[model samples]
Target: MANQYDRNPFAEEEEVNPFANNNTGSVPAASNSRLSPLPPEPVGFDYGRTVDIPLDSDRSASQNLKKKEKELQAKEADLRRREQYVAFATYLGLVLCLFWNIIAITTAWIKGEGVTIWLLALIYFIAGVPGGYVLWYRPLYRAFRTDSALSFGWFFMFYMLHIAFCVFAAVAPPVVFKGKSLAGILPAVDVLSGNTLVGIFYFIGFGLFCLESVVSIWVIQQVYMYFRGSGKQNELRREAARGALRAAV
Candidate 1:
C-alpha cells in the first residue's frame, strides 16, 4: 500500500501518441475572418424632412431683393389703378370745359350781349384745355407708367394753377358785366344768377373741373403715403426717380 501511493499515475504518459493533432497554441479562423464589415454609418439624417443646405450670402440677398421687387410691383399696380380712374375723370372734365366754352362763346357771339364775358371764357378755355393735358394727363401718365409719385411741389403747383383758372372762370362774368344782371347769356353769369339751363351746364362741367383739382390733391396724398412711408433706402429711390424725371422733362 505504501509503494502504491508513491507510484506516478500511468508513469506520466502511456507511450507518446503520434496520431493526435490537438495543438493548444493554434487559434481558430473565426477571429481573423473579416468582421462582417460593420453596418455603414448613415450620412445625413432628418426626421423624414429634406435638409436645407446653407446658402451664399450674395445669393440669399439677391433672392430677398427679387422678393421685394415683386412686392413693389404689386403695390405700384394698385396705385396705378386708382390713379388712372382719377386721370379719366380729369380728362372728362377737360373735354366738358372745352365744349362748354365753345357753346357759351357761340351763344354770346350770336346775341352780342356779353363781349367781355366771351373773351374771358375764351382765355379760360385756353388755360383749361392745354393746361389740363400738360398738368394732369402727361404727369399722371408718367407716374402710372414709371410707378412713381408726384412730389408735393409738382402737385401743389398743379392744384394752384387749376384753382387760379377755375376761380377766374367762376368769378369773372360778374366782374366783367357789373350792374347788368338781366338775360346774361354767358354760362358763368347764368350759373351765378341761377339760370336753370345754363346753371345746370356749369354745375356739371365746371364742377368736374373743380372735382378734378380736389381729387388730384387727394391722389398726391395717396402717392406720398405710399412712396414716402418707407425706409431710407426707398426714400433715396424716390428722390432719384424725381431727378431722372426732371431731366427727362
Candidate 2:
C-alpha cells in the first residue's frame, strides 16, 4: 500500500507530443502574450524580408497641411492688423467731422446769427467726447485686442447714429449771412442768403459723412461674421484640447 508510484522504473514511458509545448489549435492560448516555438521553415520557402512601402504621399500631405496652417495664421494676423487700422481711421474721420462742426459753430457764433447751431454743437461735443471715449473707442479697442467681436454693440449703435447724422447735416442748408452757418430744421428756421464758401463746406461734409456711414455699416457686419464663424470656434476647441493634453502629460 505504501509502494504506490514507485514501480515505474522498468515500465515503458508514455508517448511524447510534438506540440506539447503549445496548445492545440482548437484550444485557447495562454493569457500571457509570449509565443510558443514555431515549426521550422519548409524547404525552398523564400523567407524574404517584408517589403516596406514608403509613405511619401502621406508625408507630403502632412507637410502641405502644415504649410497651409502657417499661411492661415499669417493671413489672420494681417487681417486683424488691417481691421484695427481701418477702425482707427474711421474714428479719426469722425473726430475730424466733429472738429469741423465745432469750427462751423464758432464761425456762426462770431457772426451772431446761429444761436441754435452753436448751442447744439456745444452740447453734442460736451456729451459726445466722453461718451465716445467710453462706449465707442474703448469697446472697439478691446475687441481688436483679443480678436473678438463682443464689442460690436457699441460700434453698431455709433455708426447707425452717424448715418442719421449725415442726413441731418445734409438737410440743414447753411444759408450763410455775414459768414455764418445760419441753418435750422422745422418749427425753427434760419432764413438768410447763402454765401458760396459755406455752401461748398456743408456740401462736402454731407458727401463725406454719407460715404463714411456706408463704410462703417459694412465694417461692423464683417466683424460680426468673423466673430460668429465656426472656424474660429473649432480652432479654439482644438487648442484647448491640446492644452489639456499637455497639462495631463
In terms of TM-score, which candidate is strongest? 2
Candidate 1 ranges with C-alpha deviation above 4 Å: 1-69, 104-112, 143-156, 167-173, 176-196, 230-249
Predicted candidate 1 versus true structure: per-residue lDDT over 1-249, tens digit per residue: 367568676676668778865674694545565566788988866778976766787799999999999999798787768866775665676567556755645454445545665565666576667777777566656655654444333543575666555444443355445512212224444554644455455455555545655765666566556545544337556787989999999
Clashing pairs in 1: none
Model 2 residue runs over 4 Å out of place are: 1-56, 172-192, 230-249
> How badly does each model clash, as a count of residue pairs?
0, 0
Candidate 2 residue 80 C-alpha distance from true site, Å: 1.9
The C-alpha RMSD in Å for every predicted model, in order, reads: 12.8, 20.0
lDDT of 2 by residue, 163-235 (tens): 5654555455444332233222310223223444444444455555566566666666666566556254465
Which 10 consecutive positions of candidate 1 have the poorest summed lDDT? 179-188
TM-score of 2: 0.57
Query: Residue 194 in candidate 2 has what lDDT?
Result: 43
lDDT of candidates 1 onward, in order: 0.58, 0.60
Give lDDT: candidate 1, residue 73.
Answer: 79
